[model samples]
Target: MPETAGPAEGTTAPAFTMPASGGRTVSSTDLAGKPYLLYFYPKADTPGCTKQACGIQEALPALGKTGLTVIGISPDPMKPIEKFAAKYNLTFPLASDEDHKVAEAYGVWVEKSMYGKTYMGMERSSFLVGADGKVAKVWRKVKPEAHAAQVLEAAKGL
Candidate 1:
């Protein structure tokens, strides 16, 4: 299980590297010195997760104008992520955190209960990292709909 708490705003974003779709890997170092969004979701291709990802994908053009790159993270393995990206035509990175190390570092990996069954899973969360590598904002228990627009607005201030 992940530690009980996530990084607070103004703290330096935790660093991590994970395999991603498109035969590539994404690392925190890749986003350093730039404003970026790191979002965590439970699974790939599922309804809510897909909506969340597609929402961000839809906002990419607007978000790009602000120079804020976005990357989605999940504990699902590579194949599923590849499928998800291809299915949705996602232009941003979707990383696979099979070991959940990155999610653990971000404190988005946690115990969750669904329909009375408890298990560890990735929480629906997002972090906006400023150019200085400090976290500018954190969103926990995010709703899929309208989240991209909210994050886009928040990024405008960064």
Candidate 2:
């Protein structure tokens, strides 16, 4: 992870192009003219990450009703992400940031401490980007279990 700052609310989201599941390229610019969710997670196939992904998966209908598309980002490579999505039947796109470049740009990759040791990793977070391509809301240090419902509520208000 590199030292970078997060995009503030009402500011344009940092543009990125990353490999999505199934070897497709997905870019922030591709989402122009539509509201979308960009969620950053530490890793795939982990307990918390899986729970959060599934939660968002379950809430997709409501989010779709609100006219928002959800996309998940992580530092893991695409192969693992593909497996994770398959295992959980995820319908949303998951982008791989193997170098953590996009994660750093979003400010989700940062120094984290666990078990008294400090290291750089993706900090679980999410951003709601408006149809105009600016951030509408940010959820930092998110708790996985309730994240989807929380995001849904925020999207409804958007």
Top candidate on lDDT is 1
Q: How many clashing residue pairs are found in candidate 2?
A: 0
Q: Which clashing pairs does model 1 show?
A: none
Off by over 4 Å in 1: 1-4
Per residue, candidate 2 scores C-alpha lDDT tens digits across 29-60 of 88889899999999999999999999999999
What lDDT tens digits, residue by residue, belong to model 1 across residues 1-158? 53348788999999988888888888879887999999999999999999999999989999999999898999998999999999999989999999998888888889899999999999999999999999999999999997999999999999
Report clashes for each candidate as comma-separated counts.
0, 0
lDDT scores in order = 0.91, 0.91
What is the alpha-carbon lDDT for the whole of candidate 1? 0.91
